[model samples]
Target: MMTSDNERARLLPSAALDVLGNDLLLRCASYLDADGLVQLGRTSARFGIPQAGQERSLANEAARQRFRQSATEDERSRLPKYDGESDVGLPVSLTEGIDLEADWERNINPMFVTSSYKSAVAEQLRSQRTAKWGESNVHCCTYGCKDGRCDWTDWDNETGSFDWQGQEELEVSGTIGLLLDLDEGTLSVFKNGLCLGAMKEGLGGEYCWFVNVGSLCTIGISRGRAPN
Candidate 1:
């Protein structure tokens, strides 16, 4: 039986792989890491677009796993209602695209581009959908650090300096802010209506706002101005 199996394996050619459909291919991709998913998506356009399947895009599915083990079709259809310039605390479930003003401004504060100066940042948002995801996934926290681990700590070593002060932590259910400056190419974070300074920069491309959050976390985003 072993010899027969080996002989059959030798007879099967790489050409047979061409018969494999996107569904099977993507189903197999469920085991890949973020970087691996990104690579697989680039291999073909089908790997990136959403379709009638268990997991739409490989990259999106992998990111969604951080929220739920398996996402239903209803959950994917329910997206944040981005009605220009509103204070809506949208419940987030996946690391997905948020169609904002691309870059909106606020008259209330010169530091922020949103009316929701009170907001929490997450997932180290990239200006591009195909942004390189690494181990430097940024996390936010207002409280609950018992041991040496704090929630508001920045994990990215290349994010310049770790200037996150003790007072920078927000209160329970407090607002956290994130402003993506397209002109200056910087992403600034705010805690309870105060600026935490630019946490990231070098973003000269179009951005799709995304959040990487845990269970039962509600984040709100508000804009005061129109598109640029």
Candidate 2:
């Protein structure tokens, strides 16, 4: 029986040809790695139709990967660490003096606040309407020591970062002051002056949001008088 690698090599040529015929020899080249492209170039040369050079093949693959993995605007801003001290302070309390009843009424009733600050919050809530799920893929987080230093501490400490997958439900209100960014087909939410979570597009055009919360409880997005 043919091994998996052999099967792949045998099948890849036909697949590549079907996708990229005489019209565009570089079309299917983006899917191939260095060695695969080299083999493909050899096959093409055998047929006297060699098209892509080594540099062009490598650059195309790199470009495709970059396009696939590029982060959204919101994601770029909400990184794990900041370069300098931020003007914004952490949330005094997740839930302390928040008028849950009033906030709920405002959230559900769609009542407009007259105060400038309250209007700003309401505008933010309106902005949340644009938040949508982004690309989804298997993300692996490795926590281990490297270069004789503790690289795993970020995932080991109590307040350290952790990896998550799937739709994340968040309990946020106007009083909580959460920020959401939806750009480059990705969604990143920030709360309490920290990185709350991120979402990316997945298979079948579905998006998954992953959040690492302190406690394991059901979380959902609330905006525009509806819970997301």
Candidate 3:
């Protein structure tokens, strides 16, 4: 058979990718996280346009992937998914509603949850309990410490890294809020939806949410937007 010039042209990289199309790219994206998907979109036109709707689709997929991992199958199925059609912020596990109660481990103090990735240090957690929280891959925000004021700190044991020291003299009498903006790499604290301000900036890598519950028997955590 004679080699066709048209066939050779069609077999070129771009043409081959175009033939595979967005569906193929999306299938490849399923293996990737949101960040990977965004990067893929930037690669070529065949991967799909980086438009709002397409971005939302990628985000919805990512949110579902991020959500309810530490939860039981029954709990995950029952968990509400964030409807970006109604919500203003990006769809996330928090926005989709996470049962933090189910995500906790009871200890001497009260309870502490595992990392977002659910990789907890069993021995350390067993020893220190909630005492040396910042020693692990955990992010900490204290409301009332020994100094009788709020403090912010986080750490990564693997890399020996830590930063974010924001002290606020909050009068503990109302609902407290903590928000982690992974995109901008900032953490903000609030009081009853009132934005206190960005406590930390330029945060990097993965971090788990944590708190040192001394005398408090009950801790309530809910997710939504804090007015900017």
Top candidate on lDDT is 3
Q: Which lDDT tens digits does candidate 2 get at residues 63-167?
A: 334333453444334432223322111111111343535656424324433323355654554353321212322221222111111111111112223344432
Please identify model 2 stretches exceeding 4 Å from their true place. 1-23, 28-53, 56-59, 62-153, 160-228
Model 1 TM-score is 0.28
State, as a TM-score between 0 and 1, how close model 3 is to the true structure.
0.36
> What does candidate 1's lDDT look like per residue over 84-139, in tens digits?
31111122334354333443322122232221232232133333224333233442
Alpha carbon lDDT of each predicted model: 0.45, 0.35, 0.49
User: Using Cα atoms with residue i matched to residue i, what is each candidate's TM-score against the true structure?
Assistant: 0.28, 0.20, 0.36
Clashes of 1: 3
Off by over 4 Å in 1: 1-167, 225-228
Is 2 or 3 the stronger prediction by lDDT? 3
